[model samples]
Target: MSGIAKTPEPPYYAVIFASQRTEGDRGYGIMADKMVELAYQQEGFLGVESARDEGLGITVSYWESLEAIKNWKEHSAHKIAQDRGKAEWYAIFSLRVCKVERHSFFEM
Candidate 1:
């Protein structure tokens, strides 16, 4: 699966979301796809990476600033999505926000 988000230089923010899912889709896939599409439309949205295996999953979204991240969180559709996550999608989840002070990566 392609989960590589081409991020820019340092000083960006990363919102890391880790979770365990319920047994079946239960409309999670549709909501997730809508979120990805909606995120791209938001300002300061750098990129996103996502991975899932069995019941475990992780999603990382890049942003320009903490404010940008906050805005994304408060988005109306995203709020509904969050509610759905709590009610149906995620069995358990944890979220962490961090600043990218420095990073290095190379691809051949």
Candidate 2:
């Protein structure tokens, strides 16, 4: 082993969140960080990738099961943030969940 544990192959799900922020995002940075940390502690959460520029933000999180995704949706703090995103933070948003039947990655 190269001391770097490889990510497991196949049998995974990805939740992709794409959003456009409203006027201001004064508290969004902190809240986003908190959400990422909380997600890592959730059962079945595998990994995440996020990027933001100007007023657009995109985040993709990997999970082991649909149940885990449902649990995360029902999580209280996340619920609160979801509400805030609708009413205050996001001007527009979209969420997509896809099963990863197969995947491949390359390293330099």
Candidate 3:
């Protein structure tokens, strides 16, 4: 599953974050990496998958429950990163949270 995350089985939550970045890195790369590292330390974090090209990026992080998702959203360090994304990194972004009742995968 190369880029796909090997997440825990469903009845899980996925935080789908899609963003359009502004020109220049503005240290966004480092922040994004740090965010991933920090997320792994948080409880209920299952896995993460991300992709980006030409300033367009989409990241999906898996969690055991919505409460865990909420905690991640309110994390102090994550809050700082969010503020920076709004002020410097992203031109615009949208977030969607979905309960993964079903999923499928394939290999070739």
Q: Which ten residues in a row have the lowest lDDT in candidate 2?
A: 1-10
Candidate 2 regions exceeding 4 Å error are 1-6
Model 2, residue pairs in steric clash: none
Give the Å shift of residue 36 in candidate 1: 0.4
* Of 1 and 3, the candidate ranking higher by TM-score: 1
Better of 1 and 2 by lDDT: 1
User: What tens digits encode model 1's per-residue C-alpha lDDT throughout 1-108?
Assistant: 255888899999999999999878899999999999999999999999999899789999999999999999999999999999999989899999999999788788
Residue 67 lDDT (model 1): 91
Query: Would you estimate the TM-scores of all the predictions?
Result: 0.96, 0.90, 0.94
Model 2 Cα lDDT, one tens digit per residue, 1-108: 112223468798999999999887768778888898899899988888777889778888889999999999999999988988888999899999999898887778
* Model 3 misplaced stretches (Cα beyond 4 Å): none
Could you give me the TM-score of model 3 versus the true structure? 0.94
* C-alpha RMSD between model 1 and the true structure: 1.1
Say which prediction, candidate 1 or candidate 2, comes out ahead on TM-score: 1
Q: What's the best-to-worst order under TM-score?
A: 1, 3, 2
Off by over 4 Å in 1: none
lDDT of the candidates, in the order given? 0.93, 0.85, 0.91
The residue-by-residue lDDT of candidate 3 on 4-71, one tens digit each, is: 78876688999999999999987888988899999999999999999888968899999999999999
Give lDDT for model 3: 0.91
